[model samples]
Target: MSEQTTYEFHVAAQGDVLEQYITARGRNTFIMGPIGSGKTYGSAMRVFDQMCEQAPNSFGVRKSRFVAVRNTYPDLKGTTIKDWCDLYHNEDCQLGKFNQDFPPTHYLDFDLEDGTRVKAELVFLALDRPDAVRKLRGLQVTGFWLNEVKELSKAIVDMCDGRHGRYPSAAEGGPSWHGMIGDTNAPDDDHWYYELAEESHPEGWLFLRQPGGVIEVTVGKGEHAVTKWIANPNAENLANLPDGYYINQVQGKADDWIKINLANQYGTVATGQPIYKGQWNDVLHINNNKLLPIKSHGDLLIGFDFGRTPAAIIGHLTPLGKLRVLREYVSENMGVRSFMDFLVPELKREFPAYSKADMQAFCDPSGWGKSGNDENSPIEIINMEYGITAYATTSNKPENRWEAVRFFLTKKIDNQCAFEMSADCKTLRKGFNGGYQLRRIQVAGDARYTSVADKNKYSHPHDALQYLAQGAQGEVDYERTEQLRQTSEQTAAADSLTGY
Candidate 1:
């Protein structure tokens, strides 16, 4: 805001790539290009642009916050925002401010020799608290850029966007849009993004992929004019970082080494490795005609994974543990109102058939489900507000719940249960067959395990499974239910206290 800050990002063959991106960045609602195509660099520069505009806006100092989230902490650190800072502080950009307090949490906002102030600050966060996303609900954020979003659950994305906006101090907050960028290579055959790239209308989200990176561009205006670009930050903007850098970052990780680090595709090429030492034909249902019959009457536990991308599923269970996937619905790119238009009716139709006083749908009842990549909350807000009893499997510990899914599937594999693969449950099957990936394990005592998703990749189906499994046990502690109620009420009260 002090003076015009002149800068450009240098790329070898691309040649002054930042110049074009910096110019057209925010002017267009959304933009996408190949890897090394300058998407992140472009977006970061846009951060600078917003900061420039904010510095002079009389907010004391522009409290510009940039949110960069990934599936886990390491990915958030090693991949997404980490690389963005590299490009932003490159000698060419004339580094203003960086995360000076904690280098890992680099806050880059400094003035160049030209006296231009950098107002943008970053809030580096990871999806550690699945329920924490709702904290953003009813609030507004300046600029939110989700790096590798294919792996982010739809629920959280919506939470961020739902609360997305720039609340410049002293400015009446209406609808402030942020520059949302998504970067990813590609997802598996069953992933949600594969579907998003092809959608058109109030019906779906759009994604475009060029050689190195795939950009997920979300478009709209005011409260929702946010587009995301999903692409590879390494091969694209960081291509000139010398080969050693990638080897160090992604070396041993198979998914990283290939899907992103080396090969650009987010899918797994048949390495011919048998993750499950059994044949798929063995699990084929003999009753696989039109309308897969629900093998009824044995403690029907339903798992409802709420998501938009690949599709959320309603899995019906038999005591044998063999699940009959009853229903599957994908959100495409539509928002909550649209998603619920399909989900509520589906639940109504599906619930009655499986309804027992004890019947329940297990879900990630943490955040508001609004994005294609979000995990669906178990209890629907509309239903709840209307006094509808939406049976949900909410939990204090989600990791335990997710672990249960793996445990149940392993049991199925051991022939300890009857969970068989249905045609409609392709995402689940893919996940069980290794669609999802587990990150490198740190020394046990030192660090915790980190799991990552590849878009609608493996998690969607597994999420469905988790939701179903939640219903298996009727272990509802009325106390816990009360706690959840109290928590929600308390959150609401807190929002009120802050005048949110």
Candidate 2:
């Protein structure tokens, strides 16, 4: 077939985000939206468009290969694969039948009206399979579509990204364009997607998010108080769905579910019970303006949570006793010494105005425990090496730590939140928003959660915040107490020397 050959093929991508997503030429492109918002359909159409646009090979044939991925075999069959078939298995566009293999594959080769041949391959794989990585390693493809990417990990995405552009080798005229496309409902704030899209935002990666299907509105007053989910006027793909799809789906569903699946808000699925259930109002406790130290208010307090994943929270206690958390340092698999190396420079740069004397540091009392490798405790390392005197928090009790933070969370001065954190403190904010939580006891019929918080990425940063709160709130002034003890001892010695 000739390069001039043309066959009619068209797929209309609805909504602004989906349209942008389809047209995006970034190396990695992702679209996230509420359920039934046509994310899958748009991704499928984009794949088809990409396949058709491939540069014709030596024999006037467009060649391409694409892999579609989901989290599990069932999800691949039930959702990702089914969506592909629904879009492609039609008279207007003819692609070969999808084969039932260990990893499903569809081989397409058809001639166009003007004698151009289109050849493409579609492979579908599930991550849950034991040989998933082995299969991924063996693939060379034009591109990939990460179906329901929220269920997959960064590693899976990276692996898939590496596989693309390898299928249409240099001999086969290479791919006209190569990249990855992904679609998903909203994921939690702590998710890698959120970190990459919202924080890192590296070059050659694009993320487009459709407006939520519904918006929460307050409907009733105090005694008759109620929150309702109403259809959003700008919601996409409504024309293709049943009447009131967004509204109907929210019926009898929890607010969190509706927020995530319909509203397209980033939130956790709540496998665990939230530590600060009702106390943390994201709106109230989180300041939109980047919080900075109020120099005249009080000294900057640094809180530390030490161990494999060390974390630090830098904040200030205002004259009104409001805790204004300004910055956070969270690291994984780093020793206290290494963490200090990074933190000291950051502290100097971030809070240049504050001198060492103007900053007080507190840490988990357990930081005093020596590990096998290091005879020096974390506290000792910070003090002796970093030259920053750090005090161990009075009580390492979980309840005390929790209550110290709760005291600020529940406290209000003239209706203003006593505990306010900068919007940039995403990790800690996510933790307060439910990332750091207590695991739900999995007893049938009875709902219960453990009293102690579950340890995870969020826990370390939160633990640091607890120490800051505990120290700042006057639970015990370890520094002052020590000074007083020394003063008392000195006074007694003076009296003995005077023979009194």
TM-score of each: 0.38, 0.61
All models: lDDT?
0.48, 0.82
Any idea what lDDT model 2 has? 0.82
Off by over 4 Å in 1: 1-43, 53-63, 89-117, 134-139, 169-179, 200-206, 212-500
Error of 2 at 167 (Å): 2.4
Residue 185 CA error for candidate 2 (Å)?
3.0
Off by over 4 Å in 2: 2-6, 71-74, 95-104, 110-117, 133-139, 153-155, 187-204, 217-228, 266-326, 329-345, 351-424, 436-500
lDDT of 1 by residue, 409-480 (tens): 435434444444444444454454445444435465743434433344555655656656655544333344
Q: Write one digit per residue (lDDT tens) for candidate 2, span 333-379.
A: 99888899999989999888888778778888777788997877887
